[model samples]
Target: MTSRAVPPATAAVPVQDASLGAAVRLVRVSKTFPIAEGRALTAVDAVDLELAPGSLTALVGPSGSGKSTLLHLVGAIERADSGSLTVDGLDLVTANRRALTGYRRGVGFVFQRFHLLPALTALDNVLAPVLPDRRPGFDRVERARELFDAVGLAGREAALPSRLSGGQQQRVAIARALINRPRLLLADEPTGNLDSRTGRDVLDLLLDLRTRHPMTVVLSTHDPAIADMADHKVTLLDGRLASSSAPSAD
Candidate 1:
């Protein structure tokens, strides 16, 4: 089913618990895209949100809902039009590109397209994030293998994206996303391309990874099923918050 078909009520916003600490924070944030005549198209309005350390938060809304825009703001890929955003205490909205690159070393991303390299094997693709530049530690390949195994792609490590199933490719993307051992992970429509069963498996794997890796994860999906898995759900209505119900919306 397309993401739009699911029951949005299944996932609610997260409740704040001070124990986990704040992994990400946004206050009075807004984003606008410039149009002709120098007018602005508002994508996100003044919004405040947070992700607790080692928690899972889902940003849910339909297309053009600013869900992805919010995720990008946390990922440091794009700056907010105004206000402040912090990831693990690092100010991102005002950080320079060079600093953002350093900040990205602690942030991971999983795109809906499964941005894997077709020419390389799963292991190599995961390793690409940590090369002669990012990770200077010895045994990075071993680390990659560990991540591949963690994502349940052990024997398939040598397989190329073309040689793998869509779910497998997405798993490889997940593994690649973790290569940096980031404290915060942002995924845009992670299960959009998978069948229901495969998508469930992928979601399960993501939960397992979050538990094992102990990182804050924020994923934006048009799918409520994807959102339902999070400990926190941030819903957007017309680029504004519908609600935030966490801890237990139950």
Candidate 2:
């Protein structure tokens, strides 16, 4: 796999049970995507990962490696073919759909594409979690503003996605992901589309937020440069653990 240099220094920087704790643990996990002719595409292969509470880890790999697949497994977006996957105390491999749904709320996710609603103002997007269904008499606007402030998006709260810069839009996405105050945050190629400087800023923001509100952060990236910020980094090659080690703090 290719390892690209990170642009430069940025700065830096789970949901478990209240009692039966453990951010996440994957034991002998593997995932196989079915294909035609009784074949399968193995995306993740017997990967074992352990996440301690509030620790930040990054899964780095070239395309087609199992980083995203592993994230999906950890996020309960996909199931492992055979292995034990546990978050907090609920075993995902054996969790019922209802249990999994409840588990997911605490595991926030940010995608490569800014998934913000184009029509909704930035504030509304961030306020989604505290809507009426989740909490009665919830001040969605005020809460959204607070989050926007946290993410350094204070003024743009009233703006729509089409009016924001790439970096600004991403920051909004991050805020929205945090509306639920998740215990675990999963980000997939979060900086892929941004300029180097913007990417650096966003990364720095992530580290800063960890200090403010600690949580388990697992980010997936193919860019080695961006992966430099992670203290615990893993490399996946062809759906397997090629080299997992600590990234140099430069």
Candidate 3:
């Protein structure tokens, strides 16, 4: 008997855009950290960037190049010491705590390390984002189930992080990131922990998700191949924007 190969499942049809995806704009943005002495270390120098809504952008650079810092600034995880930042017309540099919280609710983050709870099952981990609310009307569990299935972890929801492989664990992380239905996704070296083949698969999954959601994705990576897949590329050097390129139309 001949074995038939099953094609990978595609993401579900996305809902209509509610203006969820946000365009990011940065002007002369800079951030610095104080060092041991009275001196300071600039993580991000004067940099200007513009990201269109619902676009995938790659941030590429070497170590200490400030790629991560730039992502954090956009996600509101880190504040810039100088300059201006605007996302979908909201000024991040001057946003208050309440505004920041609301803005973050519309953003998702995936880290280099799969930040899963060791003791929790895959399903529970995906539900972590909404677990604190304790709202009675929302069906977060159903949403979590759908996300797990979307990431190809349908039957493995009961498995713990310890029992899953590196790639599987990252899938769970991706599912968790989507639990909030975020419009902006920030991924910092998301494929850094997987093997080459597995990393490629993960990247494919990310691209697939982009098609199923109206979201802006900005991922930092050391891989040139990954950068090439993005619609736009931003390269950093010595904490400054070295160059940026947009894909040319055919």
Best by lDDT: 3
lDDT (Cα, tens digit) per residue for candidate 3, span 1-250: 9999977697543443436377888999999999997999999999999887787899999999999999999999998988999988888999999999988888899999999999999999998877466778778888888888888889999998999999999999999999998888999999999887898889999999878877889999988888888989999998999999965454
Provide backbone clash counts, one per model: 7, 2, 0
Prediction 3 TM-score vs. true: 0.89
lDDT, candidate 2, 59-99, per-residue tens: 98789998888988888998788989988778999899999
Q: In model 2, state the lDDT of residue 207.
A: 83
As for candidate 3, its clashing pairs are none
Candidates ranked by lDDT = 3, 1, 2
C-alpha lDDT of all candidate models, in order: 0.83, 0.82, 0.89
Across residues 100-183, which tens digit of lDDT does each residue of candidate 1 receive?
988878788999989898899888899888847564566788888898789888888888899999999999999888887887
Candidate order, TM-score descending: 3, 1, 2
Candidate 3, residue 120: how far the Cα is off, in Å: 0.9
lDDT of 2 at 161: 94
